[model samples]
Target chain A: MAREPGGEKIVNPNPMMSNGNNCQRLFRLLLGLLLAVLAAGLGYVLSSLPSPAPGLSKPVAEHLEASGVSNPVTAVLLNYRAYDTLLELGVLLLAPLGVWSLGVAARHREPLVDPVLDMLARLLVPMLILVAGYLLWAGAHAPGGAFQAGSVLAAAGVLLLLSGWWPGPAFSGLPLRVSLTAGPGVFLVAGVALMFAGGRMLEYPPPFAGALILLIEAAATWSIGITLAALFAGGRPVAGPHR
Target chain B: MSLLQPVFDIVLGLALLWLAWRAVASPDLFRGIVLFIAFGLVMALVWVRLDAPDIALAEAAIGGGLTGALLLATLARLESGGGAGTGRGKDRESEPNDE
Candidate 1:
């Protein structure tokens, strides 16, 4: 063991240990340089690309009216490439599923009963829910959409959890499961039903496209909110009598 | 106005890079996580600067807020579980020796 002049013990007293630290530092520096070079190369390549790059914006705009949403982003996500969105919902569902499959019970901590946090949670959660609803609805015409809205809703859920509010046993069992699955389930069912209704999977009739997209977004928002919060919970709820 | 926007963008880009490096290199795990969250937020601003508000919102909410919370919670759990060679315990163990 080596001691500093001020009588401080050096954890890595061995000369070889110091060499190893130098090697680690050198490796990190080299890696950073490599990444920087790669990034610069990528930027150079991007800069050389033709301005006003050819894209699908024209075609998307041409068919936007039929896609049922005034917002082009919404149209792209829900109508133009709905299958991708459906799979994304599945991927979101997989997260909580994987976490829950670990079968660990959520750690129950003693709830800190702070008046300010309690009041904030009470005030903010409802407002978040409202904002989520507005986002979902306005997504048809603006920048708002299911993902943004669901994330807001999820934020609210996270806040509630942070404030030490846990779902009741009754709500956590079947209802919770349903909410978690609702987005993907609705999407899958809609696709299958459309397939059976004399159309290809997810090929919405222009007349009903708006309604269908809205329905899916609504379900997706709820499911995403609940699913994300369940992820924050870090485990499955213990099986109550209802289960 | 145009010059100001570009200058702001440049500063933001530099800040993002600095924050990212600090977050990765910071010795303290908690400080690293907080820095990472800050990095996420700055990245969100970058997204907005690129005119991608949707991505910006998602980044702010999921990337910064939820993920930060999750990381903090995981760190707390790791500290409480007395995981060897991880988190605050290592710092605490080395603190007295340093003095």
Candidate 2:
């Protein structure tokens, strides 16, 4: 360590430790080994898992079949696991609020722009939105559902963010509050009404079980998709005419 | 679960880990952030393969999307005063946080 013209010894921050070069290399090697072990453990656990059968979650299986949703996952997500769907919507809605809150130190709002990206967004957003609707409609018989469909819409929001097309927010305190609650709210109403009539939750009298599940799922899917999209868009209040 | 799911899990999980490594190893903060977002999406795929679709949902939303936004926003915040943490002055970014 050489003294300056002012006669002070330069206290080196890291002398032998140039830049944590070996520290980083060691970290990478450790991380790789850790991941490898994780993968092996996961494979073993998954292999040991019981395969799908009639007895494995029989209630889900039977209720799913009774719902007339040709796809069992769709039935599980909408009918048996409808509460999860509802809570997921609440989570989705809460997410943007969290993001926005983290940005309390952020400047209010900046003008978003990118011409080429905007043009591409124009081409894609409509089609993507249409597909989200279709997934909700066809979930009963297909491999898709409100969650997958909503994710697609969220991707569109990313495009809009890149292109500067989104106006941001779509009535958070009211519209979001309503839509987020609507799915479970409808399911609860249906359950109570069904119990009063048939003495069971989600158990319709006869042929109605199929119809009822479908109905509840459809509403749930719509609410989920819309709420998710709005959340993705940052919950900025632009659903209605903002001009 | 589909037979292909295991293959997807193994491949995607490795890919995710790779991206995360690159994100930390990158010489540019912007590139690091982008790579991290990609890493998050791949992790979400891993969750899907693990038969935990609910975790996938939360991860995709928060891990990939919202966290990406936050990272970019923080980078933007450092536009005025830069430091090693911000990869300011220089165009390069350093390694990952203390995981």
Stretches of candidate 1 off by over 4 Å are: A1-15, A241-243, B82-99
Model 2: per-residue Cα lDDT over A165-206, one tens digit each: 544345544765576667667777887887788566655554
Name the lDDT value of residue B14 in candidate 1.
100
lDDT of 1 at B33: 92
Model 1 TM-score, all chains together: 0.88
* Candidate 1 residue-wise lDDT, A1-243, digit = tens: 222222223356567987877776797789979999999999999999999999999999999999999999999999989999999999999998887775544553667899999999999999999999999999999888999899899999989988988887888789999999999999999999999999999999999999999999999999999988888877678776412
Interface RMSD of each: 9.0, 12.9
- Candidate 1: residue A70 Cα off by (Å): 0.9
lDDT of 2: 0.63
Candidate 2: where is the Cα deviation over 4 Å?
A: A1-63, A96-109, A112-115, A165-173, A204-206, A229-243, B1-16, B24-29, B37-99
Give the 10-residue window scoring lowest on summed lDDT in candidate 1 chain A. A1-10
Q: Kindly report which residue pairs in candidate 2 clash with one another.
A: A168-A236, A169-A235, A169-A236, A169-A237, A169-A238, A170-A237, B27-B92, B27-B93
Candidate 2: Cα lDDT at A65: 56
Error of 1 at B54 (Å): 1.4
Candidate 1: lDDT of A210? 98
**CAPRI rating of model 2:** incorrect
